[model samples]
Target: MTSDLDTLFSDAFERANNTTKKFAPDVQLRLYAYYKQATKGDNFSYNNEDNLKNAFKFNAWIQLKGMDENEAKENYIKLVNSILK
Candidate 1:
C-alpha cells in the first residue's frame, strides 16, 4: 500500500503537469529540482551533453543533494500549491 505522502505527491504532480500557466525559469527549475529529488533521491547521473539547459537543470537538482525523498515531495507539493494560487 502506498503511503499518504506518496498519494499526495502523485496528485500534486498530476496537478502540476496539467496546469497551463507559464512559470518563470527559476520557478520551473525549482519544480524540476524538487520533482527529481523526490523521485531519484541521491542516485543521480547524467550524460555529458554539454547543453546549457541540461547543465542548469543538473545544477538545480544537485543542489538538493542529500534531501530526503519525503521532504522533497512535501516541498514539491507546497511549491505546486503556491503556483496554483
Candidate 2:
C-alpha cells in the first residue's frame, strides 16, 4: 500500500469519530459496532441474537458490500499496522 492508505484510514477514522453528527444516532452506533466486529478477525459469523433475531445482518451485509474491496483490504492492513506500532 502507498501513503494513500494512511490518508484514507485517517479520513475514515475522523468521520467515524463524528458518526453521530454525520448520521442518525442509531445508524452511527450500528456502524461503529459492526465495523469493530467486521475488522476484528479473519472469521465472521452473523449467526447471533442481534444479527439473526433483529435481522441486522442484512444491514451488515449492505455496509460491507458497499466497501471497495481493495481499499478496505488496505485499510485493514493499515489499521493492523497502527496497532502493532
Candidate 3:
C-alpha cells in the first residue's frame, strides 16, 4: 500500500512541477515545501547564507517540519488539485 502511494505521489509531484501553466507565488511555495518534505524529510537542510532563494526554500520546508512523508505527499496532491480548479 505504501509503495502504491509513493508511486501515486511521485506522478502527482511530477505533474505539479512539470506543468507549463504557471502557479501563483503562494501556491508555488506550498508545492516546493511539500515536495521537499516528501522527498527529503529531516535530511533536507540549508544552514548557509549562500543564497536567498535557498533560505526561502529552507524556511518553507521547515514550516511543514512535523509532517511525515506520506502526509506531505497527500498534501501535495491536494494542493495541486486546488490550484487546478
Candidate 4:
C-alpha cells in the first residue's frame, strides 16, 4: 500500500477502535481476525486460556488461517467503512 492508502487504512482502523457501534458476534470475530492478520501475519499462536473471552478471541484470530496481510487490511478497511456508514 502507498503511504496515502496506508494513512487512510490506519485512520479507518483507529476509527474502528473508537466506534461505539455494536456488531454481531460473527462480525466482531471477522473484524478481529482481519485486524490480527493485517497487522501480524499468520505466525501467531493463541495460548489456551481458561477464560471464555480469551478463548473466543483466540478462536477468532485463528480463523483467519491463511489470509494474507494485504487482503486482511482490505477487508478490515471495508468492514470499517460499512460500520461507519
Candidate 5:
C-alpha cells in the first residue's frame, strides 16, 4: 500500500501539472528540483549538454542532494499549495 505522503505527493503533482498560471523562473526551478528529488531521489543522472536550461535544472536538483524522498515530497506539496493560493 502506498503511504499517505506518497498519495498526497501524487495529488500535489496533479495539481501542479494542471495549473495554468505561469510561475517565475526561480519558482519553476524549485518545483522542478523538488519533484525530481522526490521521485528520483539522489540517483539522477543528466547528460553534459551545453544547454543552459539543463544546467540550471541539474544545479537546482543537485542542491537537494541527500534529501529524503518524503521530505522532498512534503516540500513539493507545500510549494504547490502556496502557488495555488
Candidate 6:
C-alpha cells in the first residue's frame, strides 16, 4: 500500500536528484549521509564500506555545525529522495 508520505518523498527525491548536480561540496556531503540515514536506521554502524560510501557526511556535518537540525533534515530528505528517484 502506498501512503501520501511516500508520494511526498518521491516528489521530494525527484526534485533533489535533479538538483544534486548543482549542490556544493558541503551540501553533497550532507545529502549523501542524510540519504544513507533515511534509508538505513540511525543505529547503523559506520563500517568501512558504509564510511566509504559516505566520505562526505562527516565533513558536511562539521561544516553545518551551528545550523538548524530541522532544516538539515528537510534538506537531507529532499536530497536523498532526489538521488534515489
TM-score of each: 0.95, 0.36, 0.84, 0.82, 0.95, 0.50
**Per-model lDDT:** 0.94, 0.49, 0.83, 0.82, 0.94, 0.56
Candidate 6 at 42: error in angstroms?
2.4
lDDT ranking from best candidate downward: 5, 1, 3, 4, 6, 2
Candidate 1 overall lDDT versus native: 0.94
Comparing 2 and 6 by TM-score, which wins? 6
lDDT accuracy of residue 32 in candidate 1: 96
| lDDT, candidate 3, 30-69, per-residue tens | 8999988988886766779568877777888899987998
TM-score ranking from best to worst? Answer: 1, 5, 3, 4, 6, 2
TM-score, candidate number 3: 0.84
Position 29, candidate 6: lDDT = 70
Predicted candidate 6 versus true structure: per-residue lDDT over 1-85, tens digit per residue: 9655555555666677666357667566776655554444343444456555355565444455454544545666666655555
Q: 4 or 6: which has the higher TM-score?
A: 4
Candidate 5 residues lying further than 4 Å off, grouped into runs, are: none
RMSD of each: 0.9, 8.5, 1.9, 2.0, 0.9, 6.0
Off by over 4 Å in 3: none
Which clashing pairs does model 2 show? none
Q: Which of candidates 3 and 6 is the stronger one according to TM-score?
A: 3
Clashes per prediction? 0, 0, 0, 0, 0, 3
Candidate 3, pairs of clashing residues: none
Estimate, for each residue in 10-85, the C-alpha lDDT of model 1 and write its tens digit. 9999988898998899999999999999999998988897699999999999999999999999999999999897
